[model samples]
Target: MGKGGEDYGKSEKVGFEFRDKIFPAWAKDVKECEENFQVSHEVGLSTSEVQKRLGIHGYNELEKHEGVSTLKLILDQFSDTLVRILLAAAIVSFVLAWLDGQEGGEMEITAFVEPLVIFLILIVNAIVGIWQESNAEKALEALKEIQSEHATVLRDGRKVRNLPAKELVPGDIVELRVGDKVPADMRVLSLVSSTLRVEQGSLTGESEAVSKTVRAVPEDTDIQGKKCMVFAGTTVVNGSCVCLVTQTGMKTEIGMVHSQIHEASQNEEDTPLKKKLNQFGELLTMIIGVVCALVWIINVKYFLTWEYVDGWPENFKFSFEKCTYYFEIAVALAVAAIPEGLPAVITTCLALGTRKMAQKNAIVRKLPSVETLGCTTVICSDKTGTLTTNQMAVSKLVAMGLRPGTLRSFNVEGTTYNPFDGKIEDWPVGQMDSNLQMIGKIAAVCNDAEVEKSENHYVASGMPTEAALKVLVEKMGFPGGVNSQSSSDHESILRIFPHPWISFYFSCIFFYKP
Candidate 1:
């Protein structure tokens, strides 16, 4: 159904190119998508069909262009204009020293010493730059390792198999559930529950989870407004849904953004500090060249004038040997004026600053960024996760049966998602209060969230809001916590119904367990 022939491999031979084609499934309804892709939403594609599609469309994975090559990175360190100028100066000094030796004259030790020191400085600078960039690249690779590795897909029209996310191809039906990270960009086809909510904070920077439905949205709707599409890299917060794979790898929304980021980073310009330093180096080189030229000219002119005088001193004759000596002195002065230790000092300072930042949990990718920090005056930042903790916690709770003007509210105290550390106070009511007990039971039983210990603290595996409500119920010293015997035995949660059309209410049904 994807291409022309039933065999996906043969379809490619028949010249069916689907790579460049765009499938705007977000704009189309489920029925239309089924017709367009020639797939049945119920049973999904058969094994043969899936294999064929896989052959036509490659695996779904973001292209991680290999980290900058070690050799290339090391070479790049010498590419700076300042570094190149220093290298040129070193080469000239070495050549002059060699010429002196060739002329049967004892080579001045200083001539060789200056070039050797310059060469050593260049080598150290290259090594430090290479080491920093290599570490930064490795850190990026580690981050990629944290992405979803496996996904659930419907195959052979009946079996749901867990396969590597990278093996997913277009038109495949992917099943998503709570705590599952979406492996690829997909269009919502059918929902197993009343609604599905996804935490798209990674993609949209939204603190709240977004509700998704099978209803097709207008074509003009932005990515954040799309109700029927679930993109790659987002996590499912609640409910379960079957989605049709529409795009993969660089074709997906998040992948496109990653590509843009890579492109921008590759074309990143020099920082202000680096630019100023480069300008300074160039200006200094010019001034040093002028000074060295003047020294040689003045020495040669004085020697030539004295050589023409009838009784000129023998030691002051402007001969080839004397000319060589004058040139060597000028060369040594030029080398001295040029600060060979400046680059090494700057590199060391940047390295020290980077280490300090690492201790504070900040990674500096480039050395110049360390200097940029000193010149920074203001920092504009996002408030959601940066200024505040990106976790939901219950702040206050009120009993619905409380009389008007009664001080019946309880204050809830906690930070982050850990429920064990919460404290509830200012409650005049006892635990046996019927209304308070009912609300606690409702909050606990009518939710689908779970909490588990992760390393040092407890972490939620579902919606943070639901986890907060469950935590609140626990803080009240409810018997057996959220999963208490009384609630589990009497009340069974049917389904969570998301009401995005309304402002702040989500409905859930609870049935009496016989």
Candidate 2:
């Protein structure tokens, strides 16, 4: 149905034309959306059509901007204003030394030592900066590999399992189960369970899982309120659903965010330490230039001769030997005034700071960024995963006994979702007393989370609180755990609503017998 309870038909534009249009998928009904994409509810796109769309839309993976080349990284090390000034000074010193040797009619090896030492210091600093930056980039790339690698797609009226996520294209049908990462941004078509929910905290920063539906919503609905759609990079937490892929690659919302972040990092400004060093270098160069000019003037006035020569156009003739001596002295003075070791010392200090941060599990991409972090006094961050562990497990349980005012407290053993690691402490010392047995049954029947063994470890696929409750039920040996039981058994015993979708402060499970 359309907005305001009106009937809606297929879009004016069909197929790939509507794919790149500024259209919102959540505003259209499932049938109309399928029609626009030229797909069917039962059978998905054919092999030929899937390949064609893949060529047009590209892969579902995010675009990786090209990294800095080795030559460019080395050149960038000398791009600092201070380093440029020092380079000019070193060239002048080398030329003066060469001229002095030419006047003496023999090459002097010791005169060229100053320039070589300055060049050596600068090279060492550049090497340290390049090594630290490359290591940090590798660490960041490893962290970005948390997305799903494979997905289940529907093609040619049959299910294709374990298909790589990068091969998915627009109009493809994808089946998502609990604990599965969403492969692409897709519109919900239908669900096989009573309720379907997704954990979008990585995308939306919401701690609660969002309930999904197949019904169309208003066009002006915000991203968080779009119940008819699921985005890429999110995870399915509760039930299974089949969705139609609408966007892939850089067209998806998460891809857009990655593009923005990449652009920001490329255009990052210089750190405070770099700015201060540039200003200091400029000021020092000005001072050295003034001093060199003064020395030359004093030498010209007192030491050089002003004898007249016949071949010269001008009347005065200066002593060539005395002039060359003063020029050499001026170059030496300027080179001495500038500290060639300062740049290397600064680079070494920043490198040391980066190493300390790495030891503490904090990666530093740039050397100057270490100082930037040291200047930080307050940090505002999302509390869900940054400040606390995102996983939840039961720690303690309290139940009321059959007597009027009797209460018993039992401590759950482990802090993880694994059920076999620890045992409950301070039990009632019987074959599961009446009160504890009822509590265990209620915990198992009411929870919607599924905790099962994948390989060697157990993983959970629902709300953390509910997952903790399911683990508790398993430890108490409830019938068939949670996921092993049939849906018919749950429907018969759980007549009233047991799980609360919105609030979780309290839960009620009703058991009925006819």
Candidate 3:
């Protein structure tokens, strides 16, 4: 116990901010990061060290905001201004009916009908809103479960273990392979393959897989330019790498963006449709109140002024009973003017529209979003095959030898991944040298992909770019079968180095040990 022991003791103290005290791990080289964090890239952290780091870094997960309870969501539905006004009207109506009964007059059943209807509408609307919100939250939770749950990590010298991603701490050496989601932000330490590729679509929205490198990039490199780093949530699409965990949980770059989203949602204003509906409700309420007041005043004046002839005349005698009757009539007029059923109808319609949108593969998170979409005038969209075909084929190929210029070039004709349908013509067969043949062999053997017959055509199961290359090899008069000799030899691919950001070419080393 010397300097190392003192550092460990200080790490255990309260109010120690690890991030503020150390240089950003992403900006540092792999060796520098390992030294600063006191971790071994080969053996990772010891069991005791992992526990101590967990205590200091918290869990390796995003901050989960507690979901709104069902009861609370239901109560929130009634908090709308229009709903509150209806509730107040209902209460007034019930009190008036009770006063009538206490005065010894015959209690009409119709006197309670409006209040009962209002109450029913309020309850139904609240139930629908609560159900929709709860289902959406549950679906989101299910998706999170289906993603990455456990990570393969090195611990306690040479032992490898599959631990929950949430339990992963910084400085852990994690292994990534094709189809595996990166569990945390990591710096590429070393790789078994010459090139490891990851699909950063979740973070960068790019359709192509990005290549990763062990070399440290510039300290001021932008997120997309950091070729040495692999972020959490992106999937490893090709090859494999052993990376040192630099950041985990909310400290990662993806986590920072997630935190920004949460903050923006907290400060979200009302949607356009919601704002318009509220303004309409306020205006309608004022208009109804004014109309009701005018009617009541005119009725009182008419009743007190003249006498009635038969049933057509309007004149009547002034009395307390007449005044009470006129007041009751005014209250009834105000209640009738309000469209009590309007809220129920609107809610039901919006809910139906939401269900329809979901059926069409478009999910509407909120009811008002349905109306908002209807009012939208300008819609922006990505131009990637959403409106057209993204079918790709090799239009031309130029092969060159190591000695000088072009050895032989050919024009290829194809329209998709269907390998059997394409052809190459005008080839200088006399000049089909060993270098050109080697290029074709490299294109075929270095790839870890296969094409299979699906009904009437061929479909590939790997990267589209690699699949296109395989088609090229087939059109070059080589055996184009899925189990062709070249493809069979692909099993001996020793390493692949893909240049995604720089040259878009892959260099490979092959070994055939039979």
Candidate 4:
């Protein structure tokens, strides 16, 4: 919306669009990106300029549509074709009963029983639908609340810690460290360590962390191939990096995904079950129409009056009142053919399914969605963050002995990041094998990952492989259990080579005490 404004002509605009063309940040180097966004590595956007950009770019978050309204939910329950047909039949029957009673000059309360029962069934179905859907909406809203609330940004030559992430705008310099979530899409300016990797499993479905580079990439690179960029909603795993914010809010990659999901949801296709039900409803309506017409035509003979003179074609007279009387019977027959309880039965079954899924932490926004999922035969899904926990755990540990033929193998317990939960081979681990202890000590010393206890659980930061090693050392009860400050006792770094690409290994040479 801010495009074509006074800032449209400014060369320092942060968006990818420039008039009628697109200028990608990943295709430009640090100097060009700095000039284009008016950002710097040392002194970031000033407070006043940041405020002005915030007013233009809006918050650094995806747009969330309002939840389903109560009225809409209620109306949606009656949107089925069969339900609409039944509703019409009920109204007509009620009107006919009232007219009959008025013409007879008497109150006929019991004559309205059929229509009242149909209306009651419809109301019950609507209530069940609204209740289940509303609960699902609330559950989804709760899940959306889990997000990064603050960010660290460089402003006016000083580091501002704990700045609200939503206030972050384009052109701001963001400093990302281990375990910190990226606040917006940014172009990497510099990496503080030899390996700066971002955990993009949530964004790109990559199980392993992606190594980032400061070099510019091709403009047409796909999202997964853009090695020079980090997107919002991803976390820094291994090393620190200074990046320039290029896009925020709905302009970011995650924001775009969110928009696509919202758009797709609006035009969702009918599921197999829904389509079948609709077809059956149409067929049933047609059959009922033909049957009712046949009943009226066959019963028309009862409406004819007989004359004293008998002839081939002039012996009978048509009576309009008698003919209309038999029409009520046809209407009754049509109402009887309607399946008034089908909707209620279907809704109740779906609600039960919704309850079972909710117990497993799944929410179904619509009752029909339950059937839609049941209709799935094979699902192609990203396994990294969806099917797996995305955390590395040490399941087995083996160490070579002093002799070539001598070897000791041990099974490490626990599949989570918690170091103290499980022991080696279900043993106490208090008296670990000497070889295992030595290997654990080496793993604890040479690793760069950090594990800390947060509240009730342990949180790992850095490469998952290194984190797993750190957890193993701590699980073996190494001295000074692994933490962020764990380092070599008496060693000096001589050389280090972090090959995180093809080899997926980190080689380091250290001089350590015996």
Q: What local distance difference test score does each model get?
A: 0.76, 0.77, 0.71, 0.78
- Give the root-mean-square deviation of each candidate in angstroms: 7.2, 7.2, 9.6, 6.4
In TM-score terms, candidate 3 sits at 0.69
Error of 2 at 249 (Å): 0.8
Candidate with best lDDT: 4
Candidate achieving the largest TM-score: 4
Query: lDDT by residue for model 4 over 1-514, one digit each (tens)?
Result: 1121212213343345423344578888999988888777899999999888888778887677887789999898887879888898899888888877887899677999999999999999999989988887777555233346788899999999999888988889988887788888889999877778888877778888898999987765667777889887788877788999887877776665665556666787777777888888888889888988998999877898666645445567787667767777888888889988888888889999999988766878788889999878899888886788778888887678558888666788888788877887754456666676667667876666778898888888777888899888777775566432334556766755567665756766887665
> On residues 1-514, what C-alpha lDDT tens digit does candidate 1 reach at each position?
1111122112212111364545567778989887777677777778777778877777777787856777888887876667877888899889888898778677777658878999999999989988887787676555354357898887767656678999887778888888888988789998897778898776666777888989887765667778888878888888899998887776666666666667766887788878987898889888988998999998886446443346755544457777778888888887777778888898999999988987765667789889998889999765554565557888988666457656566778887667668688765434457878887887887777777778877777678878888788777777677777788888776777866568656778888876
Error of 2 at 83 (Å): 1.7
| Cα lDDT of model 2 by residue, 322-435, tens digit | 887888788889888888888899899999988888976688888888888888899977666556556788888898866889877788898778998787886554477777
Model 3 lDDT-worst window of ten? 1-10
Give RMSD (Å) of candidate 1 vs. truth: 7.2
Give candidate 4's whole-model lDDT. 0.78
| Regions of model 2 farther than 4 Å from truth | 1-20, 91-117, 139-146, 301-303, 308-325, 352-365, 370-381, 386-389, 393-462, 466-498, 502-514
Q: Which residue pairs show backbone clashes in model 3?
A: 306-315
Ranking by lDDT: 4, 2, 1, 3
Query: Candidate 2, overall lDDT?
Result: 0.77
**Candidate 3 lDDT by residue in tens digits, 73-146:** 77868766677778878888887777777675778888788888888988898888888777766654443432
lDDT of 1 at 358: 77
Q: What is the TM-score of each candidate against the true structure?
A: 0.74, 0.73, 0.69, 0.76
